[model samples]
Target: MTDISPILEFLPCPTPEAWIEEARKPENLAVILVDHANNELKAAQSAMAIMSRYRTGKFGQNRGTSHSNEEKVGLQLKTDDQLSLLNKMSRLAREELRHYEQVLAIMARRDIPYVHLGAGRYAGQLSTAIRTFEPFRLVDTLIMGAFIEARSCERFAALSPWLDDELKKFYLSLLKSESRHFQDYLTLAEAINGASVADRVAIFAGIEQDAIESRDHHFCFHSGVPA
Candidate 1:
């Protein structure tokens, strides 16, 4: 197993008593709606990335490695490099889909309509600022995944006190998995490059920290302080 102890230390869980009190509040159903929808969208995107890059031939002729509920819409990749990249992306997509389902279950029980929050600066910046080199892009993507998962863990822990019992339990359960996901991404980056990713990690860490600290006009799973 990947050693994610360091990231675990960063979790900000609250006391149980406080968590239950917050979870029972009816207003939180809205937050749950947005949270679950965001998970669903992220999962769908990941799966789409995999399908477009890894699937072969016609859809009926060839099947994909990923077996997610999300359909493999199309295979648009032009090279083996893309297939390999999508294979890795498949792993991420699976986990994200699981997260989506988990949140959806909660929302269904609460009778809330799922509504996704907009992309935070973290993911948006990656789309706009990522390097063109494949190797560099891989490293950057891994680092970005790590940061996103870590931030999610941090927020889950932070928001626990304000959540209800079931929700709090779900969030607490997420901490370990999210921490491991962060480590997995970092490890893959190092394994692929066979070079030190420290400088890259530091560079992105600085950006991630800034993103988390800055005031934001909107709030999402990875958004910074609300404006």
Candidate 2:
């Protein structure tokens, strides 16, 4: 068997005890499963946005490059900063697309059908948040990515223990990549800004906490408190 054990030490995880207890309850299994499906959807949507805005031309279709993996070709980068931002965002988008593909494969194995639901609230909010700053755009976007990935890592760690062997293995398998993705975003944010991102971190931390804690009609990976 491939060793896919999580690098638990590296994750900023929450206490798993509560999550395990809650997840094992029969009523919560469906919730957890649905949430996982929603997570895949959100990730793919985020990746699409990154490709549409950061990679290709913001206005017209750039042509030729179509798939999620084509980062270097067909995209006309405007500036060095844009190029750098595109590279980082493209990397993230690719990873997210892979995550979506992986989860869909899992769903297929389990015979689960994922319906095409519209975008969730947190994603909409984050989309608006990304448009406000010019120079800070890339850093802000990266920080947002970090926050989302970190929280996903935290949640996976939290919920893993309650899952069955196969699910537990899958959830735990997600930690390393998710944690590394978070770190990558943070690193890019800091590197681009050339200063401590403490204040910005704190700001987005609050926003993310609110995004996670607020009640939402739809439940996704980043959905707020249960409605």
Candidate 3:
């Protein structure tokens, strides 16, 4: 098992026990898997978005459209740092998609049909802390990624004991990658800023802690205490 102590210490607080109880309920199992799949897709999209904006300097302007690799964009990577961002985000996105596929496979086998689930305020709340500028905006996004991945790792560890053997094994298997992803995002954030992001990280931690400990009607993978 991956060592989650560092990740736990990094966060402002732990996931509420009430939320864990909600998650472990048999009725909520479908909701948990579905939301987890959606979250994985969103994670991939987030990484791709970062690469498009920072590496290619163009995104969202050509939605649902495809362009050749050589096509010109607002900006292109001209530095090693920029290329590094591209490389890391590319790998992260691929991994997230793979996770999504794995979750879908599990859902299929379990006969849990994929269904619509609403978004939780956890991410939206954290995203509000992101600045509206360039370099700082990217850094803040990366830090948020770190927080999300770390929380995922923490929750996997917390929930594994309550799950059936199959899911328990699966979630446990994901810890190392999730932990690495958490560290990668933090490393990228600091690299982008050319300085330690401890201050920026602290700001998001407050928001994350509130999101977790607050009363929430939803039972999302990242939702707060059950209302």
The TM-scores of all predictions, comma-separated, are: 0.70, 0.69, 0.90
Two-way TM-score contest, 1 vs 3, winner: 3
The residue-by-residue lDDT of candidate 3 on 32-120, one tens digit each, is 99999998999999999887777654323434544442243222333766888899899999999999999999999999999999889
Sort every candidate by TM-score, greatest first: 3, 1, 2
Model 1: per-residue Cα lDDT over 1-227, one tens digit each: 33445775533321233333443356655764576468556745854653563355222323334432113323332355455556656776777778888887787897777664556675775444344444455457667676667766665676666677887788788777777666766776675545667877776766666666666665455555556
> Model 1: which ten-residue window has the lowest total lDDT?
68-77
Best by lDDT: 3
For candidate 3, give the lDDT of residue 108: 97
Candidate 3 — worst ten consecutive residues by lDDT sum?
69-78
Each candidate: RMSD = 9.5, 8.1, 6.3
lDDT of 1 at 151: 64
> Best candidate, TM-score-wise?
3
TM-score of 1: 0.70
| Better by TM-score, candidate 3 or 2 | 3
Ranking by lDDT: 3, 2, 1
lDDT of each: 0.59, 0.62, 0.87
